[model samples]
Target: MDAPISWAEARTAMHEAGRQGARPAVAVPLSETDGTTLAAPLTSRTDVPAFPASAVDGWAVRGPQPWIPEGRVLAGERPPALTRPGTCMEIATGAMVPEGTEAIVRLECAHHEHGRITGVARARRDWREAGEEVSAGEELLPAGSPVTPAVIGLAASSGHDTLHVHRPPSAAVLVFGDELKTAGLPGLGRIRDSLGPSVPSWLRRLGALPVEGPAHPVADTLEDHLAALTSALKTADIVCTTGGTMHGPADHLHPALRELGAEYLVDTVAVRPGSPMLAARLPGGKFVCGLPGNPQAALTALMTLTEPLIAGLTRRPLPSLRTVPVAEETIGRGDFTHLAAARLDTHGRAHTLGHAASSMLRGVAAGDGFVVVSPGGVVDAGMHVPFLPLPLYAGEAPVAVRQEGVPAVPLPDQAHAHSTAPR
Candidate 1:
């Protein structure tokens, strides 16, 4: 058997693969462009709101003056005559303030009378200044910037109709198995095709458009395996196949990959439960990642190797992992690093979850993240552990849930909470 590659080496290879050809382009309406990467920088032709707008439901007025209601000047309408001193104009939220207005005072701060407004109190500093939110000719959305809900709203506010964004990389997946059954279907000896649904959904989360190919039978013959791989790469920026990539009785992916002149980068990894992972780049420049058949192993490869590939294509920096303290002792085998699924409790303490077998997916799903045990000996409790975050759907950062009386070191970096997921 060939020697396996280390995690750092695999990551380096995968990241290098991300620097390939130009990504596809797409013109998406501003409303649907959230979470997409900008293909070019968007410059504001006009200031956001185009004029001074009221941030609160109040009266627009000049500074150091009492409000004297003369006539209403709602948003989108011209300011009433300022011929009289102490005159005020009523402005609604999101409404544009008329000319000569220097600031906005909340309605409650002024006294209302019959056809007159006065008795302004406690001056407000919260006026929406013109060109403050977005200036004319300013870079509205820079190229390579990922659009968030706030970004989309800001772009729309700046008068953008269509956004130029990098079209997400498309993927085709091939699952090799005769003993695998479709999800939610009855199975006797055959196992459920866990990779089929999980990999697609994961790819989508990673900002790639996933195409699921037909499942091929697990074969000992290299010819059968090569055909399956060839089909997957036909329309994919990257092809990911499950099983047969490692060194074993049915490891046909290695020989087939060699036949295609694929530049094999990492054939195996030093990580537990996912050591059989393989990565290669074809002559045409498309990348390939082969994951072990075990469900968790495939997930490990996806999170580790595949994410960098998508980041490279999309021109996004791969998110950094959060570092937290392990709440219990862990003994390492020294030959390989252990990526044990773990629960990060409310108190920020990371506890290793049992049933870390590569074949187990249920435990992985239940885990908040994973505790990485480097080659050596036991990882004692209360020791800090580095962990890769799972794809959490919530918009906010997850609060740590810690065991009672156990002190946990807070993860230093919380910026990893940001993601490319569509809001």
Candidate 2:
């Protein structure tokens, strides 16, 4: 068997695979492109502000102060040139300034006497020059950028009615454990199927459109596994299978992959709780990700492999890991990397959570994400460590508030709160 690869190596290999098989781009209207990835650079069709406009509700003075007041100009109206010397036009905010205009005198600062205006212009120009915000044909955003609400607004302001974006990849889940029950409570040594119901939600958060309907359990037999995989691959760009990742007696995932002529991109990762995870590229560029049966371990595998793959398929840049201080000492897994579930406090310190067993979900359920401890490395309190943020649903704010020049920490009100989910 091949040796387990590093967590970073696995992510990079899967991401490369997705990029090699990236989906084609399509032109979509701005209203329907919230979650898509831009396929082309977003360029400005015209200069931002388009023309010189007043930045304040004041007068557009031509040459000197003590100018005679002319007719008023509101926003969107064109005023005649200030050809007459010592003349000014009353201009509203965002109104285009006429030719030969020198400066703007704020309405409050202007002194009116004998129907003439007199005011000292501020040192800074009060009118926005043409192309002040963006020049014509300038690239606002590069290709592969995620289409966010702010991106949509920018596209609209840049004169784009429709944007060219890559379509979101689709995924399907297949639960492959006979001991897992699909409905009702666990009994008679049979456990309720958790991955079947939850994996799709995580996939959606990762920007993949999950196939419709609940995933049905696949029998432990090799025939059943092959059949389910074949059916799922027909529709989904990626198929995630739960359980049977290890080479145990009941594990048919490897055999099925071999039979399907799939090439292993990442056989396993040297990460605690998810070392049995695997990712492969099947014939024709479709992908299969094998996840351990343990709930938390499965999530770790999802983050380790599937997240980066989805990012590449959607043409988004790989998710960047941020550094956070650990509130307490964290033990590593000897030679293996440790992914410890942790929550962020208001001060941006990472507090490792208890009940973090591989089979348990409670630890991750209450935490923001995981803190990555390098192999054989013990992280002391106050030391900065790498952090992987949990996948978030569309429009949901991240658990950590990241402001420029500010520490990446949770807000006071959200210190102990989990990420908000849609009702």
Candidate 3:
């Protein structure tokens, strides 16, 4: 940490390291493949809809005639041929339309009887055509596509039994400092280990499987640091360490990293409160990130820097954030940008929270998300400020359980949430 490195410079360095580490070849089962990357392009073995079907609970009618009910066709049941004009078959939602029908008039808009029907309205034009959703032999999903719930459902509906997906990366977290204690356990003159709980959760959110640790605390010695770092590096695709990257009296990561021939991508960034973050690539094609030990600072670095590096390494596309109006003012100035924890009110406005120190996890804990307040200027109320939505686990209090089994809550339509800023 000789001088603060510019954010742009840090990003470039991390990007380069990410590129060098990008040889993803992990595979996983379909049961655990949600959000995993596709190894090859997915083409349709059969058409979506598979047949000409009704889009609504309506009567299937032949072309160019007034509606008349000939028979009833329930869903998944076939009907006889339409051999005469003005013949309409009652069809339920998702039922296959008769071979000669071109339009569907909903039951509400048509007059019906036991064996005959009439008086269909002119406005009932809701008919679903065959192959409208997917073609018979087209590419439904391209190779390298991340498997989402929608993609998996589509693939299953289109007759796929299994899919090839990139596996989650193995992550090893190492904590340095003999003074640290296991969470919730107390020892005299020792602090609880903050990085242990937080880092594993973050890695899990990034589609990585965190390897639980021996939780070794390195003394302020070069040999001690090297031994711990070497053990973690050998077992993980990525190794992240806490506390030792700093230049303070206890810092030993710099020397330990050098001993392992770790290439420095960026040792520091020009952002407030979390600039001491470091990214490096080990010689054996693994990544090692040195994160600050303060709870909030390390969390910010994970979201802003390490998350993107993980995405690049896994070949997953990073999400783009959009600008939203600020509900309050933010003060800062410089060439670098700041990711501040804030609440996005219901009306798409960002309200700044006061607790922003590197050690203050309360701001993030209470807020709905973070606002990316640029250092170039002060953002006023109603001004569009870019920000990121924190993970569902973060920015909220722990959930409670009732006596009975808790009902599953439906997720909100994230596509329409307007209060977010793009990455």
Candidate 4:
């Protein structure tokens, strides 16, 4: 068997593959730009607050206090200029401030009687100046920035009807294994298929647009694998296949890749539980990520390989790891790097969770992300370790962390003591 590459090397290799195969940018309406990556700098087409406007409901006064009343200026209307030195006009909030206005006297402070106005003007200017928030043609956000709700709002405010952004790469999941069942309880030498139903959700959170429909299942034969992969690659920029990564009799992933003339970018990674994960690029430039059959291991592969690949595909920089203190002593996997499922407390400490076996999903379901334990290293309590946060699923709330006064749980054993070869 070939030696496995380090986890970091595997991630880097897949990232480069994505960058080489990045999708072209397209102009999309501003209403549909959320979750896309910017292809060009988002520049303001017009000044924010295009005209000088009132910051409060007050009197637009010229030449100071005790001014004569003129007229009322409501929001959305262009008011006439305050030509006379002692004249004032009642102005509502957000109404354009007329030219020649010196200051604003708040409504409460002004007394109007006998068709005249008298009041003390506020110390601070009560009107917003044109282009005060943002000047026309200024870059609001740079290329590669993720289009968020705030970004969309800012784009609209700056007069952008549409934005040029990189279209999200589409992915397809191919589940392999003759012994896997799509539904019902696992029994009679057949287990329920987990990856088929879950992998698409993970891909979506990673910013990849998963092809519509449930994951396609492939039989454990070289011909079947080739057929399934060929079909998936036709529609998806990336194809994720679960199981069949090993060189066993039933494992056809490698043979299919060979027959398809795919180049191996990461044959395997040196990470516990997910060590057999592999990434390859087909001749057509689409990617293939081979995940282990184990549920937790498959998720780990998604983070280690698929996440960075999507980042590159969208022209985004590799996601940076956050450092947090360990809440308890944590063991490592000797030579292999360990990605321990963990929940982060409000205090910013990582509490490694239990039930983290390769096939178990309980730990990950309750955790915020994974805490990285470097090869051959043990992290003591209070020591800082790198954290890889899980992307938030659509409409999913953040995992609640332990609050003050909550008793800390003991650190559990590492997910697995030995590396799990691909099934």
Q: What is the TM-score of each candidate against the true structure?
A: 0.82, 0.83, 0.76, 0.89
Q: How well is each residue in 1-423 modelled by candidate 3, as lDDT tens digits?
A: 456676545554565556456675654555666757676677777877787777788777875555666788877887787767778888888887887775777778776556556555456456566677887778887665667677778877776778766665678887788788876676788888778877888787665668876655567688888887788877788887777768788888998888999887777776766778887788888888888888777876776567667666666555345465787777653545676788877877778787888877878888866666555656666767556666554212112111135332211112212233231
Which portions of model 3 show Cα errors greater than 4 Å? 24-30, 39-46, 55-80, 84-93, 102-127, 136-145, 159-165, 185-188, 215-224, 318-321, 333-337, 373-382, 393-423
Best by TM-score: 4
Residue-wise lDDT of candidate 1 within 1-423, one digit each (tens)? 468876656665676677564467788998777657788897887876576667788777664565566556666775654454466777888776766676666788766666556645346554567787788889865677666787787777777899888766788787776677775574678777788777877777766778867754445578887887787788888888887766677677888888999987678888787988988889888878898899899988886788777767776654455456777777664667667898888888888888788898878888977776665546667766557667655221112211234334322121111112111
Candidate 1's displacement at residue 328, Å, is 0.7
**Model 4 local distance difference test score:** 0.83
| Model 1 lDDT, full chain set | 0.71
Error of 1 at 260 (Å): 2.7
Model 4: how far residue 241 lies from native, Å = 1.1
Better of 1 and 2 by TM-score: 2
- lDDT string for model 2 (92-169, tens) is 999999988988999999999999999988999999999999999999988977788999999898789999999888
What is the TM-score ranking, best to worst?
Answer: 4, 2, 1, 3
Residue range 216-317, candidate 4, lDDT tens digits = 468788998988888888899999999998899999999999999988888888888798888998887889999999999999999889988998899876
Please tell me which predicted candidate would have the highest lDDT against the true structure.
2
List the lowest-lDDT window of 10 residues for candidate 2. Answer: 414-423
Point out where model 4 deviates above 4 Å: 213-216, 395-423
Candidate 2 residue pairs in clash (backbone atoms < 3 Å): none
lDDT of each: 0.71, 0.84, 0.69, 0.83
Q: List the residue pairs that clash in candidate 3.
A: 41-143, 321-421, 321-422, 321-423, 322-421, 322-422, 387-421
Q: Model 1 compared with the native: what TM-score?
A: 0.82
